[model samples]
Target: MKKLKMWLPFVTLLFMLAGTLTLQAQRKQGVTLEGYVYEMDEDQKFPVPYASVSIASLSIAVTTDENGHYVINNLPARNLQVTARFLGLEEQTQEVDLSKQQVLDFVLLVSNFRLEEIVVTAESNKAGAATASKINKTAMEHMQLTSLADVMSLLPGAATVKSDLTSVTTASIRGGSSLGTAILMDGAPISNNANMQIMSSAIGGSTPSTSGTTPSIGVDLRTITTDNIESIEVIRGVPSVEYGDITAGAIIVNSKTGRQPLTIKFNTNPNLYQGTATHGVNLGKNAGSLNYSGDYSYSVSDPREGYDYYRRVTARIGYSNTIGKWYTNTSVSFLSALDKAEPNPDDEQDVTIKRQNDLGIRANTKGTFTFNRNFFKSLEYNVQFAYTDRDSYFYDEATNATVAYSLSKQDGAVLSSIQGNKIYDVNGNLVTNVPAGEESFIAWTLPSQYQYDYTVDGRELNTFAKVKANFAGDLGATHHRMVIGADFKSDGNVGEGKIFDPLNPPYRSVSYSDATQRERSYKDIPFVNQFGLYAEENFDWEFANRHLQISAGIRYDHVLNFGGGLSPRVNASIDILPEALTLNAAF
Candidate 1:
């Protein structure tokens, strides 16, 4: 009763606010804008589907349909700046008087330039929007990146770190822990939530030296290749309500799509060698485009010793098409990464071999439907599924001078010799009999040398689905673009957890006197499910030759077997000198 009462006021306020906006939208006068976008080649013009047409000043945008047609209704009656953009094409902008005209058409030209002449830099987002940096293909090529982690150096206030594939690296945004940052590729979020690769609890404080796998933190950047990436956007400020379960920020990676020429590349450095190939094919007049890419890289920690090394291979297949009023893009990707440390024969005391392997496959589809309705502009949906298999192995030569520990999990179990087949409790009652290749407990004398090894197998599966509707309208002098959406996510692991010989287990930790190590399967763990709903209102108002743009939204998340909460956010900006300067704030 108390909790419901506490939330009543907030609920009432939300309903009232929505009602007021609806009423104002119904009373205002609005204009409808429609247009077609095209590409020209040698006196010939062809419709360009999925081209973006937007009003920069008003923050209203729409995508061209299969026939290269777009319709945006309820726009304010005034002069507006409109822009058109498409992949691999030059952008076009024009000034138009919406009060006098209703139809606009644009013919975009193919982008022509040599790669060597292009400047490499991270471009910042425009004023009156969330703070972000974008890195395009030109910049990525100039840097000669070997992995996705190399892009971090392009961000502001970030220092370059030498690339080393032998170590695991996770992304950290704005001084926050890596776990708080969300990484997404092609509108689908990558998840490491189901990773539980940990040393057996019975081993206690004996930590193993492992690399290339991040269990509790986040996705390992070393596993992601940059050869097929088209652009990357790092959002450092508050993101939209559509993004959830994040505290630091989000990293959005867009892969290459559409028609393209076949290209192959090979790069070699002192410690790294990489090869890549990418191509795109037009399936026919209206069949769509097929794109594919492959990458392989090998790196050594030290050229002299070559004891520690890393190897990665990646492949991707993508398809983009427009069927009627819907535009869809689908892709499937595969990755395999291995990190290993070989034991050097010269060092007799350092006989150890450690290896970590990561294998994964992902499939995703994103679609958008443009509607010609008065208020409802478009609907978008995304579905993604991913599975990963991880294997970690450690081997070492163990030597103990004078210690013998019990292997029994019970706190007060008796320690018996290996010759004994039966075990008895303190009260002289029979407890249990030892099985083959096993002992009741540790009863060795002193000075024992043995070989120890352990292996962990982890299998993770993640699925995500989202559907959202976009609305555009006008309320008096304010132009509005709103989004309402819901999403579902599920993460789980099913694998044969830790596997090792019970007779020759790793050395137990001295710090924990009563600790015991035992094998455990991960298949018994429960799946984590999360459902989220969000709504956002973006509006721009003009008065006295000044423009004000504000974006406000709220999100609700419910986790199965756990509680839920609400998060509200707002970002506002006011022009101080038109495009020259602006003031922005968020909460």
Candidate 2:
């Protein structure tokens, strides 16, 4: 019995050791902790490529790949503390309970400045990108930019000028016209591509010529106001093939989004006043979250104490959310403006220019999907629609009433030799003219003879859509990213004008009505369609702990109307003294 008792104790210990060993072996059966690292970008989130994720307890750390994905194998199933960090971003720490193979995602926020011993994200500080600039909310607030035009003027080789106090503002880059520069709001174009000018002449006379001057010429920067804006990105030099119909450059604007503290803002100057409200909150995991922003602004060119001559009102609202792997955003905006024609002192004035009304509306929607696939990392799509309407009226003061002037010979043929206010006598033959009645016709004056009342109306519709895919992989010793996209656009314009000239004295009569005296109108609608396909490849080689980097990229764009354009870019950077000095070159 004593021997059995001793044997029992030894047998119990052997059994216990065997059980512990078996349990550990089962737990270590190739378990792994894997997930992706992302950064919160206003309304949506994007992967932070090359982020650092570590576990101090296990003395193990790994850097994310191009798609922000990482995996740690053979980790024991238990609670652990994990930390993720990136340069110019706040660090994040989470308690992850690794039971079996677990998936956990980290969302980090952007920091105000770069941190020491931090790894930089691929898209944020592309070491070899030569012509990319970022303007954060802090910089925008410091500059107090009122419009996108103001933002572009601060860039290299870009300029925006206002000719007069009431004149509209225009933008240009590197001596390129505004038409060549693509202005983008949420990755879609917002430029006007139709005529909005109105011109008319007497019932039968030639149309009045204003020397080709038109209202709302080019992309009117004055119509764009900065409200609830988060950041702006300017691409000046060679850009990716994903962008089309752009020869000069591109400006991309991003708005505030996601859950945030509710706040109200108000600002004003001598001629401008603005107010805004913003809010953000979480709404569970399945239902996603919401972020919203709304703002109103009023501006004037002539705010003479208590009186205002020209004024404009603008309002906008934006919303964003994320559900599962899909993220969506939407926005709506409105604009209204009024202008009074400047009076001429030399011309005898009885009637004055009436108030003109210009109104516009715009809406946009965008969505993105993140997936783990063999060929693509993510898919993105965007759609936009916009409309504009305008109206104006012009009349003569001297006639005291709208009138139409007409001239005819005794044989009933119309005459066309009237020069200035001087009229010539018409003979029986259409080509025969005499000065016998010149004094009487000249005395009648051109204003009274060719007076008329007219009105002009114009409208436009614009729409755009695009789909793109992003892919990343390794080729040889270099990292590679490929982008492919297709885009389509449509623009249409409609305009109408009506003119009525009434009866005047001996030189002009409406009842007998010569060929030139009558009522007339004009109506027309023009449209344009555009389509494009593009592809680009970006590659980089790193050596010696990132002490030297060489990046090269090439883009191919095929546009329906513009044929094809090829853009090649190369950039190199070398860190000489760690964080102190770096040499960069681009071509």
Candidate 3:
């Protein structure tokens, strides 16, 4: 009986397989629609390929392809009901009368709730992926109370992280230095000081420091309160045309839209000597959002590191609105910092004492064309502009210019200024080019920079469009799900630089300031740009009953100046026990 038990089950399974195929074959008839199944809505004018589609009462079914189009050459002449499904979207159904040759199409609306599909679980934003690895720095609300530098540390590949008492923090991303990846906030490009990893001032002037001096800090990621954020998406490799330059990958950060009711909050961090308050509210029947926030901190360095000190303040005010098919966002911000550079007694051979202060403002705007329910993914266009003014004066044991536009008694280096005692001789006045002489004394020394030392003022405008996917598909589903998009970025910059002419008063002096004075002028770059196209796919499979997952994707990047190339990514994961104990690997 025991032998018969095992043998019987095996015999039964073979017959079941034979029966299943025979039934499937019988259900298919000549001159019938035998391709994959699909569901579409008015927003999408094509098949929802790779999506599950099957007859509600029968086993007759097939999945769609990369084109969102399906092809089935045979099916019986009978009335049938088919169901279709895609993740994060609603399911759909269609009824067909096979008696008469026919073709049917469907459009599925977004289901109000998606989380309802899975229950009783520890939820994390970083869902397991089959191909390529990803780190979702998707923080919200209280998460913003921290710095961007602090947030990046939570990723698996970025295990090495350090933060001083200040806001600046640094980490390693996928074995690469922190500088390897590009960082952007609300469409604004962020750059860290070449020496430390803290953010530069918002206006390109004296930006505040988050931590102590080292690694020349970049922008402090922690300051952008997650409350005002709408979404944060980062893709590793798998480069897309929509994002170019800075090769590793791209991180897309978008702010919140005021579609909900008013919200207000206050936050304080004693560790960094900071306190902040933020407010957000929607207006009019359209429910546009208006948000504002401010923060200030005073930081004192550890005696062991140095007597360095930092004080900083920053704020943001913005509005968001949607009109018909167009949506727009605008904001203005202020950032300032005062740093103390105690006298360098060690270099006293040329002993130097210095202190610098910087203040500036930045403004930004974005507009987009959107299709709420369209299938080709919503289309978007964006534009932005900014201006910055930051100036500073230096005083050494040598000199200080107390006058406006005067080159006298100043650390020398001026472009447009005058000084006294025009030395003269020769025929009547000095004949040689040296305005000043034992040597015609035309002027002394000018400030090394009239626009304030090391300042950057920028103005830029950019526009681009991209396609997005609204759903996720299974790995072994024998279907092609992808992201297809393209975009372009156009930007330019202009600012002032200091020049010295010893023959002219201001700059002639070895003195630091305009003992006399010289010349200064503004400079600008006409434009810089990026453009390209991208697409990717995830493969599905079933191996040894262990939910196998795999994904492979590639993209083509095209730069006008350097041309184009392709990048590929492969990833896989195995289930030790269904959903738990997952062993994932990627390259």
Q: Which candidate is the best by TM-score?
A: 1
Superposition TM-score, candidate 1 onto the true structure: 0.87
Q: Clashes per prediction?
A: 2, 5, 82
lDDT of 1 by residue, 1-587 (tens): 46446656755665555556656656653788888999987789999876778764443567677788888777666777788877666668887788899899999887654455534343223322567777777677767787878887778887876666767788998899889898989988999898877635465647565556657678889888888988888988777788888888889899988766787899887788899999887686668888899999989878776888999999999998877667789999999988889887678888899988989999999988866354566788999999999898889877652355556665555556665656777999986644444453564433467788888898999999999887666666777667779999999999888788866776655556555676678888899999998877777788877878787778889899997788777778788988788788888
User: What TM-score does candidate 2 get on C-alpha atoms?
Assistant: 0.63
Query: Please, what is the whole-model Cα lDDT of each candidate in the order they appear?
Result: 0.77, 0.57, 0.44
Ranking by TM-score: 1, 2, 3
lDDT of 3: 0.44
Locate the minimum summed-lDDT window of 10 residues in model 1: 119-128
Off by over 4 Å in 3: 1-146, 156-171, 186-227, 230-242, 249-254, 259-271, 302-308, 320-334, 337-375, 386-477, 498-526, 538-587
Q: Name every residue pair that clashes in candidate 1.
A: 202-516, 202-517
> What's the true lDDT of residue 213 in model 3?
30
Clashes of 3: 82
Evaluate model 2: give its lDDT: 0.57
The per-residue C-alpha lDDT of model 1 at residue 564 equals 76
Worst 10 residues of 2 by lDDT: 118-127
